[model samples]
Target: MLATRLIFVLSVVIGWTTACTPSDNSTSDIFIIGDDGPAPAETSGYFINHFGLLTTNLEVMKHFYGNVLGMRLMFEVHVTPEYSVTYMGHAQGGRNGTGFQTGTEMYREKNNLAGLLELVQFNVTDDSLVASTKRTNTFGHVGLIVPDIQETQDYLENHGIEILKRYGEPIQDFTGLIPNAFGLGEYAGAHIAAKKALMEAQGVIGIQLLLMVADPDGNLVEIQQQEQPAGAV
Candidate 1:
């Protein structure tokens, strides 16, 4: 009886704990939740399932993400009759990226892995709704996680991409939101993970306008290898 009672208590405690949860992002009441990121504490194995952009021309953006950026073309999925989900990218064989859906639009993986880009398109032919909307975050930026931050920065500058800097030093959130969200409550450990991820990110490619005061023009295009859990669909 004592053992059973102890187990029940443990379960109750765990239910109230953040660490054991499935990362449902319960605090999310708004769209574009962590755009002001070094993301929150729960970011591990999290790749953008989807992000929306506003543009007058889909072809122009596609040329960059698809042609110049080297994101693979997996398949085409319709978000709705009026919209589409263009699977512009994929990655992370182990660290799990997922898919996203909004209204009538839904996107998924070509395979079981994580980390893919889904560029939301309102109308392919006329390009009406998307053109009318301006999708830039208030900070006016794009973000990327490069494998070699220095190397990637150098390459971009050499190519005359005009690397912009908001901070004199590299930007990071050592105590990211993951720890906070999960209540792992390890400040030092979170910092180390943030540093490691920043150091190991590879080859971010694309054009981006930086936003926010923290890291301006940080990275709109990220080049990191992602991962997926075993048997993850």
Candidate 2:
């Protein structure tokens, strides 16, 4: 009887311990829950998936991203009244990149391993709607992680692209890249900064060099080299 009672108590203790302990094999939330169902995840494997911008000159922008940067144009689409979309990415092995859909529009990819750049142009636009000022750093910017930073920088310079910010330099307007939804202002920012500092001290966090350049439409583009290159998709 005593042995049976001890076994029951041990079972109870084990059950309680298992219940209180955190899970090791738990999976992180990959999709957001909603009333209907989880919404499609916007980001690919990349932390930042893709960004789009309106351009006055499609051909010029295309040449800048395609010819100068050597990125492939995945596919072009014509949407409704006078709007066209072009997707570009670093093509590898002739495979299309990661494909994603927003609303009714479907965007394709050149490779699933990285994010993409979407270029939009309006064929018919009123003068009032078409702002004279181009998309510039004043608004915000997109960042890219490449294989080789110096080589990419040299290529841009040889193609007459001005590098606004050099590598290892603190990116001006860094907060602009972060969405306002992150709630990272003041107190939160200080807390995060402190945590990051602690992580860096412990060698838990890594750093990457960043370079800033302006695209054809004067849009600021930030590019960095990936610490490790991903295999072809």
Candidate 3:
């Protein structure tokens, strides 16, 4: 029954382009896969619009992201006096690689989806709120790349956010050893144990970590720095 329904939908989607033609006398006809239509334009818009973090304290989350992280305050609106939404971003820009402007007020502008952070706060809560953390849950941390990691680290510390690890801190590399080791960058000649040791010694495995902070809701936030080449902004 499921397969029959799928075939009907597929036939409509592909404009009745099926591998086998349907017979007038047969009620059941098998569907064979066929080619799709022309591919859509490559310039279509597709990206993360905004990530929302629900919290109990609105002011704290706003301060941490807006004041401490230097994210421009896009705007703030109260769903009610007890509930509100705050939008923040690295810069004033539009979503989908359009309408980017530096030093513009977030509220004054619109459609800035490039790296927009949406923070939501509700004054009321019950026992229904499920607790989550990066360590214990599938939810991941937000990755931000700043020009100066150390400066951000200092700001976070001054605001009392814990520094989980220093930039370039080494961790055990457990990425399964690939067969074609030659093209695996630094892992070319290194075995599993050797790779682990080398990573331990160099203290650089994945991207450099500047700090890890928690929102008022205990959501982990990971911060990192961007490497700028000589004379490049």
Candidate 4:
């Protein structure tokens, strides 16, 4: 039954392409099989953690992300009346971590994970951005890692932000995409296109932060932010 359904959907998706006509109607196979299982991966992973900004008060942050996004909260921390942290999880905390924060009025301005953004809310210097601006990626933002990328993409579109597909020259691979000069950059690889495609397929939406450069600590920190609509904003 599932195979039949997949065939029907594929026909509609591929416009009933003639190439799909098989030499045999056997349900056992359609494409060549490789004995090798899934692709091998890097030992550690590409990122460490993802951080973001919330527009609402600290309590609101807890209510929406915890109650609404359905993300599990590993822990919560307090900085001040304006600042708080509610760490969210898609899985465990080793490789990738997602969380929420409300203190300095940071708004995420993008729709995909640029990487983990180290938010600096404490004003240890003379030029800290305490006041939130109308349109800025002040502290930083994080993207929701959705398995059904198309679902997320649709959700975002319905909300209002236009999704843009970027094409890379030569369709760059790992070497071209990673920051060659930095050891970590090379490890991270060129996944922006992959992530964008996944997000589009899952109908992805919500805030995405952009990372233009790495911080002095050799970490890629906060850049920009984007908020989801239909109330997640």
Clashes of each: 35, 4, 7, 26
Q: Candidate 2, which segments miss by more than 4 Å at Cα?
A: 1-49, 92-114, 127-139, 170-208, 228-233
Query: Taking the tens digit of each residue's C-alpha lDDT, what string does model 3 give over 136-155?
Result: 34445656676678887787
lDDT scores in order = 0.39, 0.56, 0.56, 0.36
Per-candidate TM-scores read: 0.37, 0.49, 0.56, 0.28
Per residue, candidate 4 scores C-alpha lDDT tens digits across 12-41 of: 434423445566754332334478765568
Clashes of 2: 4
Off by more than 4 A, model 3: 1-43, 93-104, 128-135, 171-210, 228-233
TM-score of 2: 0.49
lDDT (0-100) at residue 219 of candidate 3? 62
Backbone clashes in model 2, listed as residue pairs? 96-110, 97-109, 97-110, 97-111
Per-residue error (Å), model 3, residue 157: 2.1
> In angstroms, what RMSD does candidate 4 have relative to the true structure?
15.5
Against the correct fold, how does model 4 do in TM-score?
0.28
List the candidate numbers ranked by lDDT, top first.
Answer: 2, 3, 1, 4
Error of 1 at 232 (Å): 32
